[model samples]
Target: IRAVGTGQDALGEVTIRVREGSRIVQGKGLSTDVIEASARAYVDVLNRLASGHARSSADSAERELAQGGVARP
Candidate 1:
């Protein structure tokens, strides 16, 4: 977790990476509340994994890289 701004209104950003089988999936969230941001990040990863988005997205990225295209995160 990290802060994106300063003072009392600082935005909290959270990033979480989870390992599923042989792949690693990542999720990010930002909010004025650090805990909320963390929860959002965790839920994002869970949704991706549960919906099989992580696997397909990772496969697509690998294919793009193999074809000499940039793999975006």
Candidate 2:
């Protein structure tokens, strides 16, 4: 995770990266409010993680099976 603030009003830019197995997911946020930017960046990554969008479908299916869940056909 990396965050930077600039300008007089303190515009914020945040970058969040997450790694799962061989996959790497990145999220970015920019806002005048630093806290809002941070939350947006974090939530962006969380949404991807929750949706399994960072991993390949095949990988996700394999993981599901390993966890005793039904695999997608």
Candidate 3:
């Protein structure tokens, strides 16, 4: 978790990354509550990974995101 910025209404931003086979998956979440933001980020990563295939090039991870890797509010 990291600070969003000074004077910002949000509490913090959370970033989560996971390595599946040869690819890397990333997720981010921002919220006024730190714990909630972390959970959001964690869930985001899990969802992305679940919707993705394990076999691919490193750059394919970016492609997956571009193609709309599972997202949630």
Best by lDDT: 1
Pitting candidate 1 against candidate 2, the one with the higher lDDT is 1
**lDDT by residue (tens digit), candidate 1, 2-67:** 999899999999998787876677889899999999999999999989887775557758977999
Of 1 and 3, the candidate ahead on TM-score is: 1
By the lDDT metric, which is better: model 1 or model 3? 1
Query: What tens digits encode model 3's per-residue C-alpha lDDT throughout 1-73?
Result: 8997767575789987777766666778888888999999888888877887333444655576789984321
Clashing pairs in 1: none
The stretch of ten residues in a row with the least summed lDDT in candidate 1 is 52-61
What is the alpha-carbon lDDT for the whole of candidate 1? 0.85
The best candidate in terms of TM-score: 1
For model 1, the superposed segments whose C-alpha errors exceed 4 Å read 55-73
- Residue pairs clashing in model 3 are none
RMSD of each: 4.6, 10.7, 7.6
- Model 2 spans with C-alpha error above 4 angstroms: 1-10, 55-73
